[model samples]
Target: MSTSPPAGPTPEEMRDMLRAMTLIRRFEERASEEYMAGRIGGFLHLAIGEEAAIVGTVSALRPDDPLTSTYREHGQALARGTDPRAIMAELLGRATGICGGRGGSMHLMDRERSFYGGYGIVGGSVPLALGLAWASHYRGDDRVSVTMFGEGAANQGVVSECFNMAGLWDLPIVFLILNNQYGMGTPVERAAAVEDFYPRATAYDIESWKVDGMDVLAVRAAISEAARLAREERRPACVELLAYRYKGHSMSDPDTVRDAAEKERWKARDPLVTFERVLLGEGIMDASAIAQMQAEVDQVVDDATEFAKGSPEVPVDQLADQVYAQPWNDDPRGSALVNP
Candidate 1:
């Protein structure tokens, strides 16, 4: 007798995943619009096409697991259940932001969600993840730290150091390389002598794998296993997600370098569209149901935008409020400005 094909996610779970991806897509689109309109300041990096990789990896994780990511990480915060309004406020530099508007787009953190931050430096967050893992290992806690960085950052000396330390100490962590086929405008083939990222983990004696970043299920499966190996075995693991970004490196780039035909090929496999097809063809949801879901996601994004617009700007006087160390007020050299 043949066992029935392994059960898939429940209808509710499937819908949640699809809805999460939709929310990210719409949120990023609206963010781009707001940036262009000058409502959002500073560098803005959009992950419009990497929702599957973001949501899938986050979904596979435990709530208490600490996470770190590169500058392109609004999707990570969203997937970790940070309120969209707060995130939008952060981007808009309003006091209601998650970081009280101090961090802006490149530095978002929600301690409650265990999302440490989205570091501005290329591989800055990787070592932070390693530190968290080391803490967990030292404390005998079962938390597995996860870090997401670009393939460009994969070459960073700090990242290699973290890999070596993790392997040598058997730290519980997962290093997720979001290989979007480009390091900014430069293609992967041009950036590195050995382009395949997962294999490089072997140099540090860490187990590794690669997953289709466009396929949510595949990403979830791979990361779930990687997370398990890290947490249970108390060792390091790595995964390279093959994905593509539809936009330029940042809002400022004209995005002229990539070929139109290459973009079209990736768009044809758009994560949201492919997943929608799966939901429909598999009878998990009907067109009307999917339409309702889309409408809801749109409203969520719209509400977020309005909340951001209405929020108050961060006061300049409170600039030093979050700093942990206070300097002397009596110094003639203006240490008073920091102390005050």
Candidate 2:
């Protein structure tokens, strides 16, 4: 958890990361406001604190490499280049949204970006990501598949099964375990038999390590190295990103005294603030430049909010659409696979 970052990013690279992390933070804050105001519905999970983990790892990927994520993925999507307006509209359940408003916050996806999903199930998407890695291996493409899940998911039998398959096939995959301490109020210590989760991968002989998830450079260094090994070596790896979420598990989880105190302790090392200090301490950015970057990020989130509000809602009659994959022929009803 305390490993040092590889050589720091250049000034411009640091500035870009600062801007991206700022965008994710601002977007989550605005999304929280919208959810409370009833502009968004259903379960709304925020990644206000884990931006560095999502952003840093994603920044290290190739554009075509496939990736899947857990429900708390607004930050992941934004960091990996998903359209903000589409993501916001999806949360609002509008027709203009990604997945045509069908997937909502937990299913934002874009095949073009290789972001396979915002999976709602705890570890449901692991096999899908593994399949992608297999596809790369099969085609000799060498693209690594990244699948992220919470610490609680590490306990799933299906997760273990997939680990077996990954090792058995020598698949180019990376399991990104985001250890935020609590799995919906259940502390990891209470849930996991082993507090240190990476060792679980050793059972399958996959490479594994832990990284300081709050530090973008460190997360990048560790994840990038893992990805490189996965890509070049055609093997699987695991990374335990030590991070914390400042908000509740979802909009429905009531805030408590203990939760508030925990947030403060973690906020003292807020990823954005910490990174900004590094920028300032190193003279990469002055106060004014930092403020201007934040101001710009605020505008981006504000614009996305307005776009979601203006987007059209999905029609009730079309509810049955997108329920199943369309058949080969023009008429799905006439296709043998569909008719059968």
Candidate 3:
């Protein structure tokens, strides 16, 4: 006799997942407003449509598990429990920002939260995650390292190198490929010879899984299993999450590359909208509950924006402080002076 399928998330867990997704949506929307209003500078990438993939993957990880992310990582950081005010402050270049206003949109880090960072370079987080996993393996700890990148970064040579080493040493790590269809205007089909990314890890003897990233529960389940394989068995795994982004690659793009029909088709299955139906159908939440949650999320985003606006700017004297990991003083034998 065959065993039954695993159970789904409980009512409380479902409610939390929906709330988290709503928060990310509202935060990104407000962030776009800030950027347009000239408050947030530099390039901004919004994950308007991939909330399920982010929240699902992050929710599956342990508190101590280290995770790295690509540049489009506001959702990842938020899902990892970074305060919304701090994230907004970082975007606004405030001293209270997560990175002390040094690293902005593409480079948020919270070491205390085990969110390694959001790297600007494509595939940059892979090697860092590998190093984190290696450290855990060396220390005989079970903490897993999760590195998330897009389909575009999958082609990076460094990523393949990490895959080889991870398989060779059986490092406890999970490589999550957020295949959102387009890598800055170029479709994955046009860029990648193999559109199905999970199979790439098989060459290294690493386990792999593909999941419906539009469904939060499905993403959570798939990532949960992948993380378990890494943590319990001390092996490497890969998960390819097929999701979509509703906005342009960056705020600068006109988003004219993709066909309008394709976008509408995807929007019909919007994670938030579809999940709301699921919640209602399962009797986990009602229309009033969803409206209430949306209102609360909006208020949270508004408060975060105000907090960021009110936070102090980084002092000019502290500009060169964190340039080098270790402090260095001016000396005849050394280089020029760098004040703190």
Clashes of each: 0, 0, 0
* Selected candidate, larger TM-score, 1 vs 2: 1
lDDT tens digits, residue span 103-203, model 2: 89999999989999988888898989989999999999979999989999888888899899999999999999999888888888899888988988878
lDDT of 1: 0.90
Candidate 3, 108: how far from true, in Å? 0.8
Q: Worst lDDT window (10 residues) for model 2?
A: 1-10
For model 1, residues 1-340, the per-residue Cα lDDT tens digits are 0122323467787788899999999999999999999999999999999999998898888989999998999999998999999999999999999999888899999999999999899999999999999999999999999999999999999999999999999999999999999988999999999889988887999999787999988888788888888888787899999999999999999999999999999999999999899889999999999999899999999999999999999776675567434442444676645555
**Scored by Cα lDDT, where does model 2 land?**
0.87
**Which of the predicted structures, 2 or 3, would earn the higher TM-score when compared with the native?**
3
TM-score of 1: 0.94
**What are the per-residue Cα lDDT tens digits for candidate 3 across 43-71?**
99999999999988887888789999988
Candidate number that wins on lDDT, 1 or 2: 1
lDDT against the true structure, per candidate, is: 0.90, 0.87, 0.91
Clashing pairs in 3: none
